[model samples]
Target: MQSTYNFWLVAISFAVATLASYTALDLTGRIFLLASARLRHAWRLGGAVALGVGIWSMHFIAMLAFSLPIPLGYDFATTACSLGLAIGASYLALVMTTRARLTALRLLSGGILMGFGIAGMHYTGMAAMDMTPGIHYQPGWFAISLAIAIGASSAALWMARALSNDDARNVFQKRSGAALVMGIAISGMHYAGMAAADFPLGAVCGAANGVNTIWLAAMVSLFTLAILIVTLMLSRFDARTTFLVGAVSKLNGQIIRLATLDSLTGLPNRATLTERVERAIQSSRRERSLFAILFMDLDGFKTINDSLGHSVGDDVLAAFSQRLLQCVRSSDTVARLGGDEFVVLAEHLASREDAGVLAESVLERMRHGIWSDSQPLQVMPSIGIALYPQDGDTVDTLLKHADAAMYEAKRAGRSTYRFFERSMNEAATRTLLIQSALHEALSAGSFTLHFQPKFHGGTDSLVGAEALIRLIDSKLGTLPPLEFIPIAERSGQIVQIGYWVVRETCRQIRRWIAEGLPAMKVAVNLSPRQLLQPNLVAEMLAIVQAEGVPCQQIMFEITETVAMQDAPKTIEMIREFQANGFEIAIDDFGTGYSSLAYLQRFRVKQLKIDRFFTNGLDEHGAEGSAIVSAIIALAHSLEMDVVAEGVETESQLDILKSMQCDEMQGFLLGKPLSANDFGDLLKHRTVAA
Candidate 1:
């Protein structure tokens, strides 16, 4: 009992002696943060210094609780070796990163610190020299100290090994919290060992002796464990809240981008474009500067999309966008208005010519042609330029004039640019007036079909008649197909217009048969857009059956260019039409790429040579006669009939007859007239023959 009391007294003295050194080391570590401006790097260096100071403090603090009875030489050797191990462990911990593979650095450092701290504490406890002068060795004290040192080192080293196996866990793992648990466990082991150590032979053993030891051990253990668990729970809850907040911020950014951007082309959409334009207008007005707006449309894009699939069409549009970017300055804003349409806004332009030159550059680059299926495909653009203050002061006026200029550019040959002029507004007004009148024509049934007779050259007798469409506005006397067909096609009103043609043609055929006229075949031109419709053939057949007209008496004509778009699908549709007793004719054969392969594949009834070729046949010095001869011979070999259109002279008719052309339909026979006029001609022909 006297010896233990002396050990406690020496431990207190050693703690008081080391207090000033620990305080100085901890204060010096804070100065490391000022060496660098970067927070993260400075923190890394500071953290290493803090760890070194912590080990130093832990060592001296442990000395206050343990006492040793070793000679000065042994004490010096053990303390030097222990400090050396601690310094080496701290250096190793510096190289280890949370980003690298986990290793035993933490456990090694903790084990080294604890090992030295225990050694220091044990030596301090033994310094009192309360043993007898005989200096008899006691195995019980040696065993107790050895057991406590080995137990504490093993526990710490095991924790370090576990931490080394997983890097993620090491980063978030509660270091101080875990150290607290370990500290309590080690304290319990030390107290239990102290109780087990046998003291002097005369020493008294009492109930109060073990009672104080157990009470102190329990109090320290429970207090340390409670602190550890609460710290860990609070840290994890804070991390989860931070992660959820960051995720919501990212989602909100994505949603905002989608709302303002165009889904298909990734350009600012119409709403966003309008907002930006308004802002530019306001800025230009304040600065008293000029800006130009150019509206561009892809020329012949509809033909390309219809011929190829929409997938290829998408590639062309994307490529065009990239090309457009190369033509404008970085200050300009370019946006896609819709399909094959784009608009550019250029600020602080010196003149409208600047916008025109940019538009020309875009067209020149596109004219070189793009590749499709490894073949060169041509694409071009038509642009209309409207200057801010020069064309109009308001947004609506600028847009209106730009649209008129674009139409003017299209009228004056595509692949060109046009500047807005005052006169263009008159043309625009005319277009709008025509649009209103056409709508009235559709509702009032003012449009009519004129039948032109088709004659067999060999027999010189009527075999069939082609149904020609015409529109009669109330104000205007009569309108040709070219005047209104394109407008209808653009507005997607051609589908309805086509339906009207079919129903009215069926009604006319029934009337011809009812009037005791010969049962003549009636042919009607079908637009490619109409032919691509899935239910078109069925709808036409239904109209013929409903109107009491024979399907064989109705012939449907489609252009050669339209038939080549999807040859397989076109052939299937033709086969269905033939099965229903409706003859198919390729009208305007030579205008586009007329392929013999497509002709043989589709196997139609007739080919109507375009008027351009027929009009040339009468010129003796021209090569038109040779072209006509080749076409007729080709048709004969394919077992298909031929019809020469626009035949206006006897010489042309005679030449066609010699070429073995099966039919002729032009002004030479009779111009397309009203149905009643054609009926009168039929009566006159019957009497004359």
Candidate 2:
């Protein structure tokens, strides 16, 4: 019997197939982009169901478009089976095309399997008609139809493989064209399969009452089309989810950074280091970074505290931390672990040996760092290193192991570094043995002043001196100023020690004048605690007045660190000292991060350059000379006398003279001498007069 196809229904079926192909292909592209497994699975499952329904709707709608001399209807059971087969085939097709590397062999195999699935669905839907006389197939036409089904399936797989890997929305026209070709191939296969089926002239549908005819097909088609549309909308939402995930990740990173930084040293702690590194790994999948945790603490840092006071220790820690920053590359992370403890997070090293070299550089910088010149301070870092992956894969484990190694370095006689090992513990502590001795030594009047002469830059004649404090202990013999100063400062003894110093220096000045000797200005270093004393200016003026010495003969030197304080009271106190006739000088000028505004605010009469800048001047002439020259010119402009401390070697002396330094104090001129020796020198100066 001859049957005619309805043109409108046939066109609608093709449209449904194209829309389904476009949606499925777009989802496949999304699957390729998604790094999350859950998202990929969602798109994959949704694409399969929607595309499956669309394929089934196309076949059913096209079948309903046919008109025959005999009645035609579908059985409920068989029609449902056909729909299941279509969905299964679509799912299998999507899986094969969405592979990361879709080779020809894989595509060919997938195409064959999917072809059979589609053919089974088409033939099964034909069976749903249940023609009474029974439907037959033309042998040659049947083979040709089956061939077309397989060929079209292969073409569809090829199209999906080519276009699905890219962001299809970016190449919109190209993707649409691919979808159209796939749609035409699918429709052609369905039509050719139908052409092979023959309905006998007396045929009547046995299952005519099982399901409705054209209206049911239209309803199914509309519902499946809606599914495809929804699938496309979800693909768009997937892109938004990606953008939101990035924004959230950045905010999390910011919170970690803001929360973990140490206020004093401006370094992160152990707690947030791990979380940040983990996030880094997620964002950069390909990089395998090897980090080293150089756990360290200054060996004699407490000495800086004991002698100079905690305020100076804090400033030194801050300055040394900055020096530590400059010694390493920008990629590394530096963290302070409270007090003098610090960790350096060095990244992307090739081997454990590279971490060792980096640790060495860090140690070198800390050993020769900025300081108050008279203390003989040796606050070297006792460093311990732990490497990544081999030493530890986690941040906490690495830091812990590294700290153990650092203690090992301390035990092995500090001022050196060691790599991490399992058997490490028992750090040596010198505080218990010597801290008590500091108290006894102070009570027994062990402290004495040694004078280092400051000479005129041009005449090389002694114009003044700096009184550096020392400790002579019966138990520990003679101790360097560094040994007991930080201990004294730590125990609140430095304040009293400071008062003794002022009184003793005044007495020595009185003795020299009584001997009919020339009067010379002497600079006495004041601990920060002493500088903060409420009656400091009054007490100091009283000492000079009691000794019958002029206030100009005894100048009080506050460190550049103390001079940098912006507090109103501190500034007022400094003004009070100057107002009371005691000339104020800022010691360690280059080392302290003093600002020009603060410099102007203090209005000190003299600015002393710390040894850190002087030691490098002769060697690093271009860089160092430029800095020294700037300081001298700046000091002159402010009507302040410029003194270069730690000026050793003729080269340094000559350089200082060329720069027009007002005064120079260092070993090159003379070592610090006793009060008796200073008197004898003064006696000779009187003889010269």
Cα RMSD for candidates in order: 9.6, 14.5
- Model 1 bad stretches (over 4 Å): 1-237, 240-248, 275-291, 298-323, 326-331, 346-357, 364-382, 408-423, 430-446, 458-460, 474-477, 618-620, 649-651, 686-689
Each candidate structure's TM-score, on Cα atoms with residue i matched to residue i, is 0.68, 0.42
List, residue by residue over 1-689, the lDDT tens digit for candidate 1.
32332344233323322221222122222222123347334434543333333333243333333322321112344444544443443333333322234345655554555555554444433332233331233567555655665555545445433343212453324443445545554444344434444345443222112223323433533443343334334334544554577679888977877777766677776667777778878988999888888888887687567656688888777777766766688888888877888888888887767777877877776676443445444467888888888888777787788878987888787789999999999988877776776777778987899989888888887777888889888676788887777666655567788888878888877777789877778898888678767788899888888888889888889888778867888899999999999999998988877888888888899999999899888664359999988888998899999999999999899888988899999998878877888877776663212
Per-residue lDDT tens digits of candidate 2, residues 1-689? Answer: 88999888899899998997787677777777778778667777777888888998999899988878766788889999998999899888878877778788888788888889988999999999888888898887777767777787778877766776553455778779878987898898889888888888877888766456667767977797888888888787876787689779998987766688776777776556666655544433357766678888987676567556888898778776777787788988787878898887777787888998998887776667554443433456889998776666666677778887886787676878899876553222344445666667656887788998888887877788888888776766777776667556655678778878888898888888888878878999887667656687888888788878888887888788766653465578778888877888888997777678778777888999889889889778789999999999999998899999998899999999999999898998878989989888876652211
Q: lDDT of candidate 1?
A: 0.66
What's the C-alpha lDDT at position 281 in model 2? 41
User: Which of the numbered candidates is closest to the native, going by highest TM-score?
Assistant: 1
Distance from true position, residue 162, model 2, in Å?
5.3
